[model samples]
Target: MTISFSDLPIRDEFRGMTPYGAPQAPLPVALNVNENTHPIPDDVATDIVDSVSLAVRDLNRYPDREFSLLREAFAGYLGHGLSAENVWAANGSNEVLQHILQAFAGPDRTVMGFGPTYSMYPLLTQATGAQWFAGERGPDFSLTAASAVAQVEEVNPNVILLCAPNNPTGTPLPLDVIAAVYDATDGIVVVDEAYFEFAPHDAPSALTLLDGRPRLVVSRTMSKAFAFAGARVGYLAADPAFIDALRLVRLPYHLSSLTQVAALAALRHADTMLATVDNIVEQRDRISATLTALGYRPYESWTNFVLFGGVADPQATFLALYERGILIRDVGIPGHMRVSAGTEEETTAFLDALASLEF
Candidate 1:
């Protein structure tokens, strides 16, 4: 029998969603998605194809459900105490989050976090039929550790979704605060560091917290610092048992052989990716300096993107830049626009785009 949504009543909130679509651009300098404007090297691409081609014979068969090879490469490159036993691979960080919600979050349960986070945490929870609890951040877009900890201790959510160098804002929570919240909450804490590479060294190490806390899970993605947006290799590091739960729900052969090969290749040359990261940091400083000079009050960003206030209306600024062939996200924080830190050329282009704008 075929099912039709027209005949059934689903959740009312689903209908309230604004359809989450954005306009597509041509030649798409594509700064909107926080992707690295740089592509992988020709040599790395060649290696990926070569390795995947060799693994092609097993394409008809299912892949290693554990993705040990990728995990080994991941742990090796990241240089943390991560082992294959403690890692969970997925289609993307998004999938890892979905698995977390499926395993920990449920209808009567809740996933709590601060506002202006990774945007998808609440969406993921709602999609999984769980309640989303959001605590407002201070005016600086910086979340106070004490407030965040209080919310967790009080709400006692099933999953604590956190983003250090939180998306859209790029400010990190204090380390002691993260530890305090962990000590306070018995539930799983999922610290998403999609922008971890750019964060300061003294920032709380989510990996370190995994030891004492059985439920601490940190989600990472190659799509960010590794410059592999198309690769879609994101993972979580946590207690081996928690990782095993992900395997049960994850589809067999979830990641393509080619994608795994590409991730491995990128990881092999982690230094190259890091060089680009250093460049992004430089670009961030340059752009931030320029914005400050323009009287744009910017939050202290530790990620590859910057957010600013003091403009008349950020929507107008975004539209003006959009007309100039640059696409940035209007974070809806009045006078605040988020621009991804790009290469020097792209950074200058963005500055020019902004200079040409009337807003």
Candidate 2:
């Protein structure tokens, strides 16, 4: 009488597919997922609580379908001559990405991304019923303009996803590569800059190329630099027409009143909330330098985490750190693992635990 999930009349696409899971464990020093380990400053938390409390009083009313104020705040924070008309937001960057795919890629369309990039790109594409076309990167996980353009020409996909400072490898995508790829295809081009705030201040953003590029989108999240992972606010900037397209597919009043107000409160304290970036960058560098000294090849990262290779046995090293109440990620890359840059003490704990592992 027992029926497995496979026995259900589910869509063929989902039969063997697994959910996106980053291992969740209750370890004392957790650096597994790339979360900002710093707690929200007390003052900021108080203001957020105040905002949420006020919003709760109007619970009978549906939240703003447009989320106009929040969008304006985001545009201001981004400060690239952007306005509310050019920005869109969702519960998280993942949802923002989902909306893009739903609007621009589905069924007969193809969505492409370079391999060993963000693990979510293909998953999102598949969920949208779009064919996922995985392109290639250089051996060092780098993507050049020529290589990217060539791949775009081959696929001619309906959508191209570029993860700047790609996950799992932490290799940054240059602006020229993005520009070349965009020119090579007539499809929607998305640049996920979830980690851009952690990059050097002088590094140019994909936003700089947004002018006259109606098909281009630049996405960001509060999860890393803003220490607002729990708040789950993510947004993007693109042509106003592109933002309008997402509206066609999104649920009405998708962002709740609580979510909107909390995000607005966080945006109000942008400078204070982002002050942790410098410290996190320092810790990230510390992780990379120590990994190199430990004979591991730590890739140059513009993100909050470090992806290091040279472990003789990744699982063994992962477990050893876990046993010591320190958690990191084994991102399914052979001889490699990733760890977030945590607060100073937390970083020290992870580094000490990793160093003690004989492998």
The most accurate candidate by lDDT is: 2
RMSD for all candidates, in order, please. Answer: 2.5, 0.8
lDDT of 2 by residue, 62-96 (tens): 99999999999999999889999999999999999
* Model 2 pairs in collision: none
C-alpha RMSD in Å of predicted model 2 compared with the true structure = 0.8
The digit string of per-residue lDDT tens for model 1 on 1-359 reads 88755446977757556444445577345577788877777777787788878888878877666677988887776557778788877778998899999888978899998887777888889988899999778888777668887777788888888888788888876667677878788888888888888876566567777776778888899888888877788988888889877766777678877677767877877887766887888888888899898888778988888887778977777777877888888866666788889988889999877876774
Stretches of model 2 off by over 4 angstroms after superposition:
none
User: 132, model 2: CA deviation in Å?
Assistant: 0.7
Error of 1 at 168 (Å): 0.7
Model 2 C-alpha lDDT versus the unseen true structure: 0.93
lDDT of 1 at 211: 77
Clash list (residue pairs), candidate 1:
none
